[model samples]
Target: MNVHIEVRRVNEAGEERTRTASIRDVARAADVSYQTVSRVLNDHPSIRPATKQRVLDAMEELRYRPNQAARALVTSRSSTLGVILGSRGEYGPTSSLAAFEDSAREHGYWVNSAYLRDTQPETIRAAVEHLRRQSVEGIVVHAPQVRVFDILAELDVDIPYLGLNTAERGIVELAEDQMRGGKMATEHLIELGHVEIVHVAGPQDWIEAESRMRGYLHALSDADLPTRAPILGDWTADFGYRAALELSHRLDFTAVFAANDAMAVGLMHGFRDVGIDVPRRVSIVGFDDIPLAAHSWPPLTTVHQQFAGLGRRAVTELLRLINADDAPPLLASVEPSLVVRASTARAFGHQ
Candidate 1:
């Protein structure tokens, strides 16, 4: 009679150890090929159910675990996406980041985030480089500053990239219809019989602010109303306060269209401090109906940009680009709606 016994090896510590098992080991135990084990490990749909079960059972019996790092190297895909966002404490950026996170999670991708307070070209390049070093499959740039566009233009990254709240520049761009949003706010105020309107604009460096200012101008021109240079603000309540103080000296306009709801709320407070009543004296309208817009003394009538949807779409587009070999870059826009609230009413005497 002939008999065979499996022999294990012992190290200097005198502990017996079995050789580390691989997909080949599992396949041999399961009476399958290495390729079949690989397909099962990757959850390929074409694998037969029974075969997959046998491979899984073999892996269990051999106590085998896949080396994820080696697998990523072989596939050249890290299954991760990078997002660069502004550090500003504002509704637009904050809401967008949240939406991107939710969307990426649903798509089975992990998000790595980087925040910048000021969008300098060098800073953006550094962020992109950092994400690339991590081998993220793609990047989602949430910087709305035009400077970001300039910076991105200089980089020669082979990996796919997407922009959120910015226009397309040879890459996927997703944003709300800012021009429409601005027009909606202005037209609503105009319909309410406010002929003289002032726009308290945000920082000109941001594409959103610039687009909104254009829309405001377009609405005024279409209505044949006179246009004035926008009073620049920094998308901050404090800036709106100072702007309102400056405007109070002139007191020439019957209505104010602030770039965003924060400025609108601030303008209302500033007006109140100067003995001016909202809607009663000067009707106010704002863009980006942030949460605070509704909680104002009199709820704010403003344009609601679907920030969450924009964020979700940005991630979707980024993923699409990442998975495709020759996917055309796209520019997607989410529609914004006007929300009528107490902050606006027909010009005092027009009603």
Candidate 2:
């Protein structure tokens, strides 16, 4: 008997041409029944083990390949989730996405990623719409900008969603305690007998930056030290460099707490250019104990945020949201810890 294979072809007008093939053609080749072949192809679990093997063998003999799109049409599940991120080059966002992808794969889901340079409301709306079009079951918004939350609040999508690293109001959120991180860094400096401490802060618009700034003030107030206005930065090495240059000219403070390790590294270089000795003339502390922090001159004393763990937890929460598994939406806040290193020392007089 001739075994014919069905194929789809596009006509000159771009319409599909469908053709049919017979199950008898497949079953005869492997000496199995058409019923057994149907059961094996449809993944019916009731078939006996020996019979199932014969049906599979028949399919192999006929070189049968199942149509995934047809299967999806019946199930109504695309088995995909969407992740929207801000700034792919940043350490935290990039690491979170990688972790989420791995976790999604483990749960038998595919992740569609979209990275944005800025988190404007319109841009976020567009991104969310794009993901919805792809039939994603849920969404993980990784943009930390406060405006993204506003955009999310206005969205009409029926799918469940979660935000990582953004502030919490009513929605489910997963973030590090930035205020605690700031307080930890500042209090450490104060404990070292550095009363005149300055903060080099990240952009004011970002919730993380604002929280850290508040923590710094809280620490200073508790210690009875005067809190100076913080110098603003864009969380970049360049911004840190420029801020350091401006601060070095006057040299009013004995200690500095930069919002992140990259800025701290930049400040160190800036101070070196001005012929100032670190931990002697001025001690410095930084947040986010990134890899480069350890290699910096005199090594950086910094705050460690468990970025990878944050990523893992965020994805886990997102998966729960996707499954409609009767789990409560989680609001997780990770605490920051201080990592003491060589960049800080006793006050100039005590040493």
Q: TM-scores across all candidates?
A: 0.84, 0.81
Q: C-alpha displacement of 6 in model 2, angstroms?
A: 9.4
* Span of 10 residues, lowest total lDDT, candidate 1: 1-10
Ten contiguous residues with the weakest lDDT in model 2: 167-176
lDDT accuracy of residue 102 in candidate 2? 83
Residues 168-190 of candidate 2 have per-residue lDDT tens digits of: 53223334377888999999988
Q: Give me the overall lDDT of model 1.
A: 0.81
Local distance difference test scores for all models: 0.81, 0.78
Q: Quick one: best TM-score, which candidate?
A: 1
**Model 2 backbone overlap count:** 0
| Cα-based lDDT at residue 191, candidate 1 | 94
lDDT per residue as tens, model 1, 33-127: 99999889778999999999988888877778887667778778776789887655778888877888888889877788777767777777788
**RMSD, one per candidate, in order:** 4.9, 4.7
Clashes of each: 0, 0
